[model samples]
Target: MNPVATWRRLLAEFAGTALLVTAVVGSGVMATTLSPDDVGLQLLENSVATAFALGALILTFGPVSGAHFNPVVSAADWFLGRRAGTGLTAGDLGGYALAQTLGAIAGSILANLMFDLAAVDFSGRDRSAGHLWLGEVVATAGLILLIFALARSGRSAVAPAAVGAYIGAAYWFTSSTSFANPAVTIGRAFTDTFAGIAPASVPGFVVAQLVGLAAGAALTLALYPGVGQAADEVVVAHDGGTAPTHAGRP
Candidate 1:
């Protein structure tokens, strides 16, 4: 890829992740404020907003950056690609991760500013719990499975909706409200709100996410044996009207 193209891709990843965290944190704060008396309603509002935002972001940025808004997702993509000799380059992986982490922190600050709070407040909310960790595993596993499977089957078009819906549902079903993304988890730490997690709780959530990533990858390979290699293909029209799948970036 051209150097300019690589930088553009990295920039897209950074901007995409920042906007995602903005939605997650901003919605959580607004929902909590609006539904002070009802935790359930707050979560519902937050999840709905997040789901819709996620779908829009992916659809908008997928072609440019694969729309990886999470640290685990970025790492997984690089791993899968390298394994198949067709994914992101090593330099791109590191750049993506760095950009995502920085964007997440910036997003948290932005959300706080929007809500008339300190720009960077360390959360005191105690979210460390065994059940929560388990939830992270389940949430992340489902997410990875969905994305990779979509890519494998050439149904990447539906990923925006599918991923968004899965995440929204996971918020209700999972014990931790599905903080499946490490970048999101870290970003939420800067706010002491309904969506915030204490700095101490972050490590456990990250660990669980990593475990889930591994489990999801294993499951993907087992379910779709050639997914790693075929996931980067695109269907192209030839001289005739027929469209054939060929190896390309997802």
Candidate 2:
């Protein structure tokens, strides 16, 4: 890949993540402030809206950046062989992760400003280890399963929609409110906005997400043996042409 392309992809990731977090956190703030007596209903509305918006954003920007708005998704793509070896380099991961974190923080700050909900407690009252762990497992599993199903079926064209829908559903089904992205989880700690998590609780959420990611990856491989090989070969062939040396996934 050209250096220019790499830079463009990174920038796209930054933009996509920023937009995604903004939609999610921003809507949460709006729903909480505007709802009269149905906070749950408001959150549900916000969740679905965020899902559709995020899907649109991914479809609009995926071609440019692989639409990796989350580090876990990027890492999963690398493992599934969708990303070229050079594309998943340490530098690339660092850039993407940093961009995602910063974007999420910016989005949270914006949400705070928009609602004047900055002083609200962001942490969920129940932070039990078992509850958090279960939330992470369910949320991450749902996300990875959606991604794997779409990509493996050659329906990469609709991956964004599938992922978005999964996230929206996960919010209601899971206990942790569907924080499947580690970067976003950490970034939410900085603000005490509608979507913010306490900084003290960020590490636990992150660890849960990582564990969930690992479990999801393992399950995907077990369920779809050899599916990743073709993807790896394609990435290898693509990177072989004028790109730097690195190992492809699978």
Candidate 3:
């Protein structure tokens, strides 16, 4: 791809992730404000907002960057597509990850500023527990499985709504409230709000997520042996109906 096109994709990842995190952190703040005495209500409000925003962001940016707001997704795309030579190159993967991470951080700051809180208040909410790690693994694994399954089955059309609905449900089913995305997890750490995960908890969550990514990939391959053929279209095909042909750009 040309430099301009590459930059557009990178910027799409950045902006999409930023807006997603903004919705998450901002809604959490608003939820607490609106439902001061009810944790369940606050979570419901937060999750609903996040789910809607996530789906919208994906629909808006999917054509530009495949709407990969998570490092694991990008990595999985590269891994699955490596053999078939249909997905992102190593350089693009790196760029996407960096942009997403930075965007998450910036999003946290934006949410804090909007809520009149400290810009960089590291979360104190300790979420480091064996069960929480299990939840992360489950959440991330399910997410990967769902995305790849949709791609492999040629059902990418409903990805936006399906992904959003899955995440919203995961929030209630998973013990960790489903911080399925590494970038989102890191972003939540920057805020001391209802959605914030303590900085110390991040490493464990990320590790579990990576493990989940592996498990999910194995499952996808087992279920759809030719899933790799759809790697360039994972989440969604964003190359103007053409898959990226940079198979040699390792």
Candidate 4:
């Protein structure tokens, strides 16, 4: 991949992830402040709204950047051969990871400002140990399975919708409320909003997500055999040696 294209893709990931977390946490804050007695309903509403927002954002940006709003997803894409290995080099991973982390923080700050919920405390509020770990595994596995299915089926065009819907559903099905992205989880730590997770607990959540992703990838490899190679088609360069156009499959 061209260096310039790599930079553009990284920038797109930064912008897209910022918008995703902003919409998710921002809506959570809104739901909490506006709802009367049903906090569960509020969380459901916020999660669904975030899912739709994420779908639209991915639809708009996936062609340019692969719409990897999460580090686990990026790492999985690398493992599946869908990313330009050269573009996701150590330096590139550092840049993307930093951008994602900062973007989540910015999103949280924005959500707090918008909802005037800055006074809420965020420490020691996250679910941990026992049931939470199992929930994380289920949610993360669901997310990766959705991604693998869509990408493998050559339906990359609709991957955003599929992924978004899976997340929305996972919110209801999982006990820990589906924290599928590490960057998003960490960013939520700074806020006392509806989606907030305690900072001290983020490492455990992240580790669980990674484990879930690994399990999901292994399952996909076993079930589909050649699916990883098929999904890899999405990011390959084109005939002219330049990065392929949005309309072209790799």
Q: Candidate 3 at residue 80, lDDT?
A: 89
Residue 10 displacement in candidate 4 (angstroms): 1.5
Tens digits of lDDT, candidate 4, 1-250: 3334767777877788878878988888778768858888898889889889988988766666667778877666666654434324455566667777777777777777777666334645766776887898888877877776556656666676778888888888888889878888888887866788888789889999999889887877776555545443332221222322233232
Each prediction's TM-score against the native? 0.91, 0.82, 0.94, 0.85
lDDT against the true structure, per candidate, is: 0.79, 0.68, 0.88, 0.71
lDDT string for model 3 (1-250, tens) is 2223888898999999999999999999999999999999999999999999999998898888888899999999998888987778899899999999999999999999999999999999999999999999999999999998888777676788999999999999999999988998999899999999999999999999999999998988888777778886768676544443433222
Maximum-lDDT candidate: 3
**Cα RMSD for candidates in order:** 4.1, 5.3, 4.1, 4.2
Write one digit per residue (lDDT tens) for candidate 2, span 214-242: 88878877876544543322111222222
Q: Write the candidate numbers in order of decreasing lDDT.
A: 3, 1, 4, 2
lDDT of 2 at 227: 45
**After superposition, candidate 1 runs with Cα above 4 Å error:** 1-4, 231-250
The clash numbers for all candidates, in the given order, read 1, 0, 0, 0
In TM-score terms, which candidate is top? 3
Superposition-based RMSD of candidate 4 using all C-alpha atoms, in angstroms: 4.2
Where does candidate 3 stray beyond 4 Å? 1-4, 239-250
| Model 1 worst lDDT run, 10 consecutive residues | 234-243
**Between candidates 1 and 2, the lDDT winner:** 1
Question: Worst 10-residue stretch by lDDT in candidate 3?
Answer: 241-250
Model 1 C-alpha lDDT versus the unseen true structure? 0.79
